[model samples]
Target: MEKQVKKKKKKRCSKVKKKMISSLLVLFAILLAVPVVSAQTSLNNNVPSSNSDATLTSEEQKKLDERTIILKEYFLNVEMAKAELDKLKEAQSENVGPRASLVEIDKKIEVAALRVEELKEKLPVGLEKIQTAKESGNVSALSSAADYAITEIQIFWDSTQSKYLAHTAGNFTSTNWKKDRETDPYMTGWRDFGGYDGYSVYSLHYNINIYNPNFQTIHHADHTQYTDWTSTASTYPDARGYAWKYQDKGYQNWPIWMTDWADYNNWRQLGWYFFDFVGGKPSGNASFSASFGHTWASTTINSISYPAGFGWSTNSNRWDKGQSKAFTF
Candidate 1:
C-alpha cells in the first residue's frame, strides 16, 4: 500500500510539471508577438500598409481630393476676373465709340469684383489644408497646389490681350474704303498703319496723271514712299500725324509739292498734297497746332495774287481739321 501511494504522488508531480512547462512556452510566444503587432500598428498609422486585407479610409481621402479641386478652380476664376478688368480699362482708354459699350463694361467689372471676393474667401481655407498636407510630407498635394496657381496666372495673361483687341475693334480708323493697290489690295491692311501709339505704321501709294486735249499725258507718274508713326505722345518727330515740334538738331523739313490742276475746270479745283510728320511725345499741358499757306504770282491777264492760311486744334480724342481759307485770284 505504501509503494502504490508513492507511485501515484510521483505520477501527479510529473503531470503538473509538464502542464507548467507548456503554459510557460505559450506565454513566451505571446510576449514575442506583442512587439511585432505594436510595430505594425505604428507603421500603418504613418504609411499605407501592404497587407492584402488593409485599406485606407476612402471617405476621408475623397473629401480631401474634392477640396483640392475646388480650390484650384477658385484660383482660376480669380485670375480670369483680373484679366477681364484689365481689358475693360484698355477699351475705355482707346476711344472705342458707342457710350452703351461702356455700360456693358461696367457690368463686367462688377461681376469680376464679386468673383474675386469669392475667391479670396476660399483661398485661406484651401491654403491651410495644403500646408497641413505638406507638414505631413505629402509631396503630391504640394505639387498640385503649385501647379494650379501657375496655370491660372498663365491663362489670365494670355487671354487679357486678346480680349482687349476684341473690345476696341483693333483701334478705330476712319478710312473704310477698300481697293487693290500695289502694296495692300485688301484695304484691311490699313490697320497695319492706324492707331494712336507710335507702335502702328503703314505705307501708302498713289498715282495721278494730267492729260492734254490731244490725249498726250502732260503730267507723268509721281511716286513717293512715306514713313508714319502713331502715338499718344511724341517721342520722335515724323512718327504718325500728331502734335510735335521740329527738333533743332536732326530735323529735316519734308519737301512740299502741289499738283497742277489747270487741265480740270471748276470755279476752284482741288489738289492733294502729301506731308510726312513724326508723332510728338505727350506733355501735361501740350496742345496740337497746325498751319499751312499758299503763295501765287500775278497773272498777265488780271494782276491778282493772294495767300491763304489754315489751322486746327488738337483734342484728347479725335484729330479735328481747322478751317481752310481760299486764296483770291
Candidate 2:
C-alpha cells in the first residue's frame, strides 16, 4: 500500500525531492540527536491532547499508531525540504562555485521550497479531518483515534526537536563571554536618562556556533532578571527616594562588538541593566540570576555606587560567571 502511495507521491515530487527521499532515513536518524527548527515551538506550540492510548481499545490503538506513523512521515518531508531550502539559499547568497553553479542551486531552492509549502499545506487537511470527525459526534472509533493521533504526533515532533536542541525552548548553543570590562567610577547617573528607570547597557558576548550552520545570531533579553540589591551594602536605596531595581534593557544595543557579527553569529548577546534606589549606603553590590531554556548564568557586581544606581556591567562586573544548571523548563 505504501509502495502505491509513494508511487503517487513521486509524480508530484520534483527531482529535488527524490534526492531528499534517498537520504531520508539518514536525516531522520540524525534528527533524533540534532534538535531542529527554531520556529518549531513558535509555529504550533499546542499542549498535548487529553485523549491517550491507555483509554483506547486495542483496535483503536492500532489505528492511532498507523495514523501517527503516516503523519510523522509527512511532517518530516516538510522539515527535510525546509532544511534543504535553507542550505540552498545560504549557498546561493554566498555565490559559491561558478555562476552556472549558483543558477542550478537557485533552481533547486525553488523546487525544494515548493515541496515544503505543499507538504505544509496538506498537513492541515488531515488534522482538520480528524477535528471534523470529533465534532460531528459520529465515527467514534475514528474520533478516538484522531485525538490519540494528534497527541502522538505532537509528542513525536517534540521528540524530534529535542534531538538538536538538547537545550530546548531556545535553540542557540552556549558560548563563553568575551570579557569587555569597565573601570569603576563614582557613578551618580545612568548611561541613558531613563529617569528612575535609567539604565546603562551591559552586554555579554558569546561567539557561538550552535552546530547548525543555519542558526543565526540571536539577540534577546532573558526571560527574567534575577537581581538583588543590598540596602545595607550599597548606598541607601530610599535615601535617593528610589528603591534599587534591575532589568533587561528591553531593546537591542548597537554595542561596539556588533560589528564582529559579520564573522559568525558569534556574540550571542544578552542585554541587562540595573536601575533602582534605596535610602542606604552609596556603594554596595548587586547580584543576578539569568536563564533562557537550557542555558543559565549568574553575576554579581560589588562596585554598585549610589547616585549612579547600578552603573553598567560589561563582563559579569569584570568577573566571569559559571554556567547555571537550574532551569524551570
Candidate 3:
C-alpha cells in the first residue's frame, strides 16, 4: 500500500511541472508576435513606425528636409552677420569711418544681435528635444527665446606723484651694561591714486622704507657689543578693501609684505626694501604707507661703567631723515 501511494504522488508533481512550462511557452509566443502586429498597424494607419530602421513617409521626409534647409541657412546667416559686425568695429577703432559711421555701426550691431536671436530660435528646443522631434517628424508647436547682455570692461591707470616724507628716531646709549632697550619707528605713508572705484593694476613700482640712519649700540659689560638695527616694509593692492566685495571679485587679497625682516648690522643699516606689484586691484585712489621700529639692549652683568671703557660713540646712532621714492604704474 505504501509503495503505491509514493508512485501516485510522483506522477502528480510531473503533471504540475508540465503546466508551468506550457504557460511560459504561450507568453514567449505572444511577445514574439507583438512587434509583427505593431508593424502591420503602422503600415495600415500610414504613420511613421518607432521600430529601429523604419523608413519615414514621403510627407514626413519632405518636412524634415525643409527643417534641415532652414537650419543650414540660419547658421550661415549668423556667421556672416558676426563677421560683418567685427569688421565694422575694427574700422571704427582705426578711425577710418566718418562721424555718420558710428550711427551706422550701432544699427549694424543691433541687426547682428537680432540675427543671432533668430538663428537661436530656429532650433526652438534643446538638443535632446530637437533630436526627439526630428525622429518623430513632428515639429508643429515649438518656440524659444534668446537673452543677450553686454559686458563692459573699464580700464584705469594712475600713480602716486606727490612727495610726502615722514621720519622716526632710533637712539639710546648707557654707561652701565645691565638693561634692555628697544627702538621701534612706526613709519608708514599712503597717497590716494584716485579716479577708480574698482580696478586692476597690471604693473607698479613703489619705494617706502627707513633711510639715512645710524645704528644704536648694545654694549656688553665686558667690552663685547652688537649694534642693533632691523626694518620691515609692505605694499597692499587694497589694504582697506571691503570683505564682501572680494567674494564677487573671485579672489582674496591680504596685505603683501616682505616675508623676511630687513636686518641691519654695520654694513647694512638702512632702507627696509622696495616693492614691485604686478597684478592687483581695487582700482581708484589707493593709499599706501610703511612703518619701522628698532630696539637696543645690553647684556646683564654684576656691575658696569658708562662713557668710560665702552669705546663706542658715534653720531649715526639716530635716524636722520625718511624719504619716499617715485611710484610708477
Candidate 4:
C-alpha cells in the first residue's frame, strides 16, 4: 500500500508541475504581448475537485477549499499582471510615462508572477497518496491518509544577491538552485561553494525534500536552506533561493535543522521558521525575506543563541528573498 502511495505521489507531482508551467504560457500570451479585447479574461478557477470521497473530514475539506480559492486568485493576479506589463511595454514604446516608473512596474510584475508559480508548485505535489487511499474505498484508512495531505504548507524562501560598490546584479539564486531540482518527496542535493566566518561550508545544499509518511498524522513540512557567505567579501553579496514544503507523521523540524547545520557551529540563524496546524492563509509575504544568505557579512542579526532557533527573525534589512505556499486538494 505504501509503495502504491509513493508511486501515485510521484505521478501526481509531475502532473501538477506540468500544469503549473503550462498555465504561464497562456498568461504570457493573453496578458503581456497581446491586447485585451474583452476585460474578462479566462482564468484557471481551480474549483474543488468533484471527487466525492469521504476520506477527508469537514475540517480537512475546508482547508483544501481555501487553497483552491487561493490558486484562483493567483491565476487572476497573473492575468492582471500581464495586462499591466503590456501597458508598461506600450508606454515605454510610446514614451507615455517615465522609463524608470515603467521599469519598476515591470520588476514588480516579475516578482509577483514568480511568487505565484512557486506557491502553485508546492501545493499539489505528492497529493495522490490521499487519492490512492480513497480509491480503495476505505474511509477509515482514508482518515489516516488525510495526514498524507499536508493541511498547511509554509515556505521560507531564499534570496541571493551581490553588490560591488554601487552596482549589484543577481537574484539568480532561483535559477541556479533550479539546476538541481528534484521532484521526489525525499531527497537532498549539494554542491561545493566557498565558506565564510572561518566555517568550512565548502558545499551548500540547495534542495531539501521531506517525504514523511507514517501510519497517520499531519504536520506542516517546513524547509530552510542557506548559502552563508561568498569566497570574497563585498558591501553586498548574492544568494539564490526556491520554495520548500514539509510533512509530519511523528516528525520534528528541529532535527532537520540540527542535521542541516552540523557543519556551521558559529553561524547565526539569520532567520528562522516555525509552523503550526491551526490553519494558514496562502499569501506570498508570509515568509518572503528568507533565502540562501547575504552578499555582505554584517553580523547576522536575528541571532537566537546557539542551535535553538525556530520562528522568524526581528531584523529585516538583509537582501534575502524567497517564497512559500500552502494548499489542499
Candidate 5:
C-alpha cells in the first residue's frame, strides 16, 4: 500500500511542472508582442505630414506667418480702395461741369490703377516665395518680399489720396494781382493817380495813348514880395497920388499863363513847393509879390511862403493881394 501511494505522488508532480512551463511561454509571447505594437504606434506618430516640413525655428515660423497675414490684409485693403476710387471717378464723369483737372486726374487714376493691379498680380508670386523662404529658413527672402509688399501698399494709399484731391478739389492756383488808375484831375497841371490792391506787382506793363490836341492858358500866382516906401531922395516921388512911386508891383516868376496837357497819366508826386506868405510894408520902396502852389492826386497839396499879405500902404492903411485856391484831383 505505501509503495502505490509514492508512485501516484510522482505522477502528479510531473503534470504540475508541465502546466507551469506552458504558463511561462504564454507570458513571454505577450511581452514580445507589446514591444512591437508600441514601436508601430510611435513610428506612426512621428511620421511627417507632408514632405514640405518647414526648416525654420519656431520663432521664425511665427514671424513669417505674421508677415503673411499682414500682406494679405494689405491686398484686401487696396482692393477696397480701388473700388471707392472707381466710384468717385464714375460720379465725377456723370456730373460734369468745369472739370479743369479732369484730364490730369484721369491719367493719374489710370497709372495708379495699373500699379495696383500689377501689385495684386504679383501677390501670388510673393506668397510662393514666402512659403519657400519659410521652408528653407531663408529670412532674407522673406524680408525682401515683405518690404516690397509694404512699399507697394503704401504707394497705393498715397495715390488714392492724390486721386481724391484731383477729383474732389481743383488744382492749386497762384493768387494774382490787380491794378486801378485814376485819370480825372480837378485842375490843369494836376496829376493822375495809380494804385494796386492785390498780390505785389513784380513787373509792370502799360499802354498809353494821347489824342485830341488841345491847350489852355490860365493866370497863376507864382510868388509875391512887398516893400514899404523910404524917405530917401532916391525914392521916386508919388506919381499916381500914392505914397510911393509904385503902389504895389506884382512880379511873376513862373509863367502865370499855362497850357493844358493833351493827355497826361504820369501821376506820381516826386516833389512840390507851395506858399502861404504874409508880409508887412512900412514906409519903404515899391512892393512886389508872387505865389506858387502844387498838387497831385485827390488828397495831396503843397504850398510855399515868401511875401504876399499887406500891412501899411502909401495910400490905404492896409493893402492885400494874398489869395488861396480850392482844387481837387
Candidate 6:
C-alpha cells in the first residue's frame, strides 16, 4: 500500500511539471511576437512600405503643388510687366511734349528686371537640377522655388503698369496741330462760279474789238478790264437796236461809271457794243478769273491774322496759344 501511494504522487508531479513547461513556452512566444508586431505597425504607419526609398508625404506633395502654382503666376506677372514697360517707353519717345517723368518710370522697370534676375539666382539649383527634379516628380522643392520667382515677377509687372498709366495720361493731355492748303484755282462765270471764302481779291478779264463803219476800215483793238463781279443777268437787251434782245449776253466793255445800262438803246448810243456779235447777237465771248485766300484760322483770337495779334495778350495776362496748360495753373 505505501509503494503504490508513492508511485501515484510521482506521476502527479511529472504531469504538473509538463503543464508548467508548456505554459512558459506559450508566454515566451507571445512576448516575442508582441515586439515584432509593434515594430511593423509603427513602420507601416509612418512610411510607405512598398518603396522604402520614398520619404515625402501627401501633405508635403500638396505644399509642393501650391508652390509650383505660385511660381508660375509670378513668372507670368514678370512677363506682363516687361511688356507694359516697353509700351511706356515707346509712348514716351513718340510724345512731342515734355516727358521727364518717363525717365523715372524706365529706371523703375530696370530695377524690377534686376530684382527678378536676382531671385532666379537665389533659387536652389541650376537649370539642370530643376529640370531633373521636375521630371522626377519632386514637386515640393520645385514649387518652393517657383513661389519666390513668381513673387519677383508680380512686383515688377505691377510697377510697370503704374508707370504706363502715368505716361498714357500725359499723352492724353497733350495737343496737336496741323495745317492744310487749297491747291486748285477758282472757277467763275455767269452760269456757275466757285470761289474761296477768305480770298482778298477775285479778278476776271475779257477781250474787246471795235468796228468803225464810217471810216470804211476795220479798227481792231484788244483791251482787258477786271472787276470784283460775279455772274451776269440771264437776259439783256441789245444796245444797237431799238428792240430788246433776250439772250445770255455777258457784260463786256461796260464803263464802270455808267450804271443802269439795262436799256439796249442806251448801251448802243454810248458806242459800247459787245464783241463777237453777229446780227446783234453775242458769239465768241470768253473770260477767265483768278482768286486768292487764306486756309486755316487760329483758335485763339490773338493768333487770328498775323504779326500784330499773333502774340498779343489779354487783360488777364494769360498765354493764349503755343503753350501747354498742364502743370501750370
* Candidate with best lDDT: 2
lDDT of each: 0.24, 0.29, 0.26, 0.27, 0.24, 0.24
Off by over 4 Å in 6: 1-61, 124-329
For model 1, state the Cα shift of residue 94 in Å.
Answer: 2.6
Candidates 1 and 5 compared: the better one by TM-score is 1
What lDDT does model 6 reach?
A: 0.24
What is the C-alpha lDDT profile of model 3 across 14-91, one tens digit per residue? Answer: 999999999999999999887433211111211121111224466744543443333323333443344445445545
RMSD of each: 35.3, 25.3, 34.7, 24.6, 50.3, 47.5
lDDT of 2 by residue, 1-329 (tens): 99999987787677768888879978888889965533222222111111211244566445444443444344434544554565577577777697888888978988988887787667523343111112223211111111011111110112321211111011122212212122123322112111111111111111111111111112212211111111111221222122223221122234434422111121221211111212221232221122211111333333332234343333332222112111111
Each candidate structure's TM-score, on Cα atoms with residue i matched to residue i, is: 0.21, 0.28, 0.20, 0.19, 0.19, 0.19
Worst 10-residue stretch by lDDT in candidate 4? 160-169
Model 3 segments beyond 4 Å from truth? 1-60, 122-329
lDDT of 3 at 47: 19
Report the number of backbone clashes for model 4. Answer: 20
Quote the lDDT for 72 in model 4.
38
Q: How close is candidate 2 to the true structure, as a TM-score?
A: 0.28
At residue 291, give the lDDT of candidate 4.
Answer: 26
- Judging by TM-score against the true structure, name the best candidate: 2
Segments of candidate 4 deviating more than 4 angstroms: 1-41, 47-59, 78-86, 93-329
Q: Give residue 22's error in model 5 in angstroms.
A: 77
Residue 282 lDDT (model 5): 20
Candidate 1, residues 128-205: lDDT per residue as tens digits? 210111232311111111101111101010121111000000111111111101122222212211122111111111
